[model samples]
Target chain A: MDLERPLPTPITPECRPYWEGAREGKLMITKCRACGKPFMYPRVSCPFCASRDIGWVQASGRGRLFSFEIAHQILNKAFKVKTPVVLAMVELEEGPRLLSNLVGIAPDPKQIRCDMPVEVCFEKLTDEISLPMFRPVGGAR
Target chain B: MSDLARMRELSNAVGIVGVDESDEIGTLPGKSQLTLHVEAITNAARDAGIKVSEIDGVFTAGQHSPATIGEAIGVVPRYVDGTTVGGCSFIIMVGHAMVALYHGLCDVAVVCHGESGRSGVGVSPRRDTALPGQFEFPYGFGGAPTYFGLITTRHMHEYGTTLEQWAQVAVSTRKWAALNPKARNREPLTVKDVLDSRPVVWPFNILNICLVTDAGGAVILTRADRAKDCAKKPVYVRGAGEGSEHVMLTQMRNLTFSEATQRSGAKAFAMAGVKSTDFDHIMLYDAFTSGPPLMLEALGLAKRGEGVHFFAEGRSTPGGKLPINTNGGGLSYTHSGMYGIFPIIEATRQLRGECGARQVPNARMSLVNGMGGMLSAAGTLVLSNEGSR
Candidate 1:
């Protein structure tokens, strides 16, 4: 097993708030004040309406497994991930999708299904960063 | 005239005069990226029976600028395009060169591509601090296989596309590879062989992915009038189109279908004034086994959810109704990271009846579609040996 430290997310000005919320065990996303639509990966403006009146808001932290792949090969040697890691896209209840890791379950095709309910959980990586991951809604943490 | 009419007038206004690959394609560890570019450019110019000095326009994509390539090749190009939208940049450059030729911006244009995909010679080190690097990479998103596999997984969930159907593409393409001496993997393949291959990602075996090698290719184009004087048969550029959607997979409008493919295919088909049935040969980028089926459906070449049948039923194989990826494709032939130029070269060769064994007999019209990034961009070209009406 490679114990190399995983690459850290380079926090941008627009995404700092989302990372800050993750440290506090809160799921935060941006919603457009003009269009009343929510989006992810924290941006300064709403992608739907091109409005800069977007602001950060707490999300439900609930989502569905939109799509995923169980990777048996790792491209980046710095990533300290086990083989068969479930790399997935989770569609938040707030409507935007997030690229995240699906954990707390066996990485098997028979065990995972699309549209399965999932909820966000944070793992603190350092003093300032926590990654938001998802698992089956009722599965063991 | 309206914009549509003027756009239609540009159809068949330019034709491809020459096309060739680097002297040695499969694995040239000794060759640098720029060396591959120069070799392909020189070979293509020689094939066209023109001096490198006659190339007035230079177009290319990748780490190096067009000016650098033009300078190294001893050409002072008046018009140059450095459209680096990924692998499909070369295919898209064909369209740009056509417009440049039609407007007399340059008389002869050469679009070049050379990548040290496997050798890593003169290759630029990529550092991704962008949106994808910040978000997706942290989740152990392993390069192309995992990125493209997400689409296949979602397609399976949405439309019940099966693993067997995906393997069919690999099996069919290998049959074509067996005929080309230049192909990398020429052994006979079966659906069973594909299914039994090592797993890289769920729903994808090692056979499902494109081979990583080092190669370079170039295509020369000129006005239709000047094409008659070229060394080879002029493969008329009947129509061309290019488009893009999103940089990240999550931002893709729909996981099962590609909006970029549809947009580019529609524009190309419309400009050509032909239906999908008009093509005698077809070549869709096969970065993964699932690429052709998804793109076939998106391009309306096959009915929705039935694109896999084109390969599974052997309709796209040699002697089939619609021969696709006749050069063995990126899967079995050579995928030098960016595979866009190889398809153009194959289509041009097929149209000229130069393909000795794997030739599509009487192949008059051909369609080539290329995908860049992770289904982020697309470029479509409709070529015909017959001149414009």
Candidate 2:
């Protein structure tokens, strides 16, 4: 198992656009046409109003660090080299939070703070899959 | 009738006549998860002094069907419930059982849970295979510890909750473990010990995480009136309610507190016609050290962001204002993956005056809170001695 690449997530019909967008360097979120509520972890319908009239919108690719943890002991063998991995929850500027990895910075609590500004960075793991990771904006790695 | 009124009508309509566990609480390597369920169910039936055939309703949470359980137990249940959320699934089943008894859907109900969390003998939910797996797994969302670690981290960042406050939870729970002969880890623990423990996930050391043991438990419910005919005194279910917001932790609107717990606790209290202050004992599921404070806030016993303060103040510890988790909790007791059932059993034991050393003095009422699915699902139960109401 390569530490640089973990297992790929199984794509479903509802989330195919999300992966496709990541591959194109665009972070996608669903906006409900009826209620105008936006959400992540893609959906077939608006989670709030159950609106079928949903469209994919490019996210600002900017977010804030809501919370994070430095997994000192890697649970997944695929990320063994990335010990002390920065697993984080990034709340998008558009109003939904999604789980992602924080890169381009030390995986230390002293370096990470809640509400820190972050921008999306895509990691092209395969021809079809690209993981959306976040990094501290203008911060030293 | 309003939902609360309907719940109130069901309140105390059913009583828990029996509660028991599998042959062991921790590390039964040779036993299968199904065997644990059978053992627990059989023990509960024996404890209730009722034949297995009397159970007209069979309910469980996670990975198993009523048809499978009924076939194993050798009875065809008229009603079946398999509501799988996570650890709190069993607690939610109890609430469902009360309604079933009240509505005459079944005369007797058995709620069971069994897991081979440590042994790895049973089927466990694979987050990597779920719909969100595409988003979660690749980035190292391993399981409960990482998921809960994020909540704990955000809570600390928001509430100024310190590491010592988290460690204090482990310290206090260990004191409770010292009194229970069945508890796995009974040694004295200190804040320093917790802080010094090896890290599994950030903000959570080995002591902060629940022990993964293989165990199972079951509880039997019957109509309150029929409970009088049982050999053992019944622990009346005065109130019960369940709620869920989201299964994934990332989607939770608020990271500092659980909305499901607040809703469920409020509904349970309203149905029981009581408040948080009325309880003689409390049992909040302790899957992780961070849970107690968060749950305390959700239950309205403590203010938001003050859960750590509430726990640090020694309010929930032994010889304190409100005795909690007298069975040592999942922190020091057995946590066979889903820890919801043990608290219900402990609450029942406390209400019946059956806990010898760990007994709450003359305990008339007890509150039990069970959580599941990354603090996504919550079930609260308000129970009392038969005479309390």
Among these predictions, the greatest DockQ belongs to 2
Per-residue lDDT of model 2, residues A1-141, tens digit only: 244756555678888888888899999988898999898777778889998998888999998999999887866666545578888999999999989889898878897898999999988787777889999998556
Candidate 1 local lDDT, B1-389, one digit each (tens): 88678779989999999899998888889999998999999999998888899999999998778999999998799999999888998999999999999999999999999999999999987756667666877788757888898899999998888999999999899989998999999999989999999999887899999999999999999999999999998999998999999878888889888899999999899889999788989999999999999989989988878899889545899888889899999999999999999999999999999999899999999999999988899999999999864
Task: Name model 2 segments beyond 4 Å from true.
Answer: A1-3, B124-128, B387-389
- Report the lDDT tens digits of candidate 2 across residue range B108-211: 99999888888878765553475556777788886789899999999899888888989988888888889999999999989999999998888889999888
A83, model 1: CA deviation in Å? 1.3
Judged by DockQ cut-offs, the docking class of candidate 2 is medium
Indicate the docking level reached by candidate 1: medium
- What ranges in model 1 sit over 4 Å off? A1-5
DockQ of each: 0.70, 0.73
Residue A62's lDDT in candidate 1 = 97
Q: What's the CA RMSD of model 1 in angstroms?
A: 1.5
TM-score of predicted chain A against the true chain A, for each candidate: 0.92, 0.91
